[model samples]
Target: MATTGVITVSAVVLRNAAGSSVLTVRKRGTTSFMFPGGKPEPGETAAETLIRELEEELGVNLDPAALRPLGVFRAAAANETGFEVEATVFEHPTVPIGGPAAEIDEVRWLDLGLEIIPDDIAPLTALMLPALRADPRER
Candidate 1:
């Protein structure tokens, strides 16, 4: 049997302000902006993977107290990588620390209603945007 493992985990982080959402542009070789996260290491839980990824990718340490589970979504990897991904999404209140890491070329807060998020990430965005826009306080 061909096996498909969930290849990545991600988080939809909202700023303290209600109207914005975080998006990170991939470094030159990749396509589309995405939430801050990556593949999990051995034995790590989804939440643990999320926290570590956020720190490595964005340079911010997420307060466990502020981590809110959003939902999980599956999508084709944007890069045409054969592995499909199941992203466990979370919402968090964050402060920017050091600049975005090298893998991230740019970072911006997008208007949930206005940006053209890539198709691969669209499903996760679709699931979370409405609530983020309606109530920043919700996960």
Candidate 2:
């Protein structure tokens, strides 16, 4: 059956060393940046989807056991008009290895403190900012 309306994605909110910034990526032709992840394959859990996507886009390998649940986030899809993304978010500590591969066009470590309204951004990213910046370690 074809899915409709909101698209669900699983994403990781990884922080760079010292936890000063969070990682975001712009896909192949998109300028807006968001957490790294994608839609799940049939029968796959959100964490499994994130593990697969991270490897494809960032050359990062992960043990599904390592991911910690953050929460579910929702906002308008960045590039897909008229749709929203319902993201199941996770947090992992390790920074990625080689990146900007596959559908990824750019890799950026944006400070959690940066204004949520950047020139170009995924709505999901904007929605997560306040919580990220509010984390005791981020302050």
Candidate 3:
């Protein structure tokens, strides 16, 4: 397949209290579960994008100060064919309690403790799962 242009986005890893699990979401028509976030709007910073996305998708308002940079990653786009995703990932200081909203169809708590992640996950989630599982911690 021919490569499409990259999609820039921001995402967060919201771990459960035990850090055994992290939050993931599936958009309305998407099969692959991914971190709860979306692409940035015009002129939005990464943290701003995350805060807006969280509020829109999960009805949770996040403080920019509470987001810790996890690193940037690039992977095959989960739902968009022939495109790559460039994600600025963050680790949330605490899990925000919320349900699926907006374009989100389902909210799932993915068990990081599992030896193998399920096949129905976005490439970016799969890429980071190992590191998260190896270093589970409580906030």
Q: Which candidate has the highest TM-score of all?
A: 3
Which residue pairs in model 3 clash with each other?
Answer: none
- Tell me, by lDDT, which candidate is best: 3
Q: How accurate is candidate 1 locally (lDDT)?
A: 0.63
lDDT minimum window of 10 residues, candidate 3: 92-101
Tens-digit lDDT string for candidate 2 (1-139): 3324798899998887777788889999888999889999999999999999999899998778778898998888888887888999998876546768999999988877665468776889888888878882621
Higher-scoring candidate on TM-score, 2 or 3: 3
Off by over 4 Å in 1: 1-6, 115-123, 136-139
Residue 97 deviation, candidate 2, in Å? 2.7
4-122, model 3: which lDDT tens digit per residue?
A: 78999999999888888999999998899999888999999999999999998898888788899999999999999999999999988675668888999999999987887799989
Query: All models: lDDT?
Result: 0.63, 0.84, 0.90
Q: Model 2 clash pairs? A: none
lDDT of 1 by residue, 24-109 (tens): 44544665656677777999888888778777766778777777887888765555455556788877765654577847776755
**Residue 56 error for model 3, in Å?**
0.9
- Give the number of colliding residue pairs in candidate 3: 0
For candidate 1, the clash count comes to 0
Quote the lDDT for 99 in model 1: 70
Model 3 ranges with Cα > 4 A deviation: none
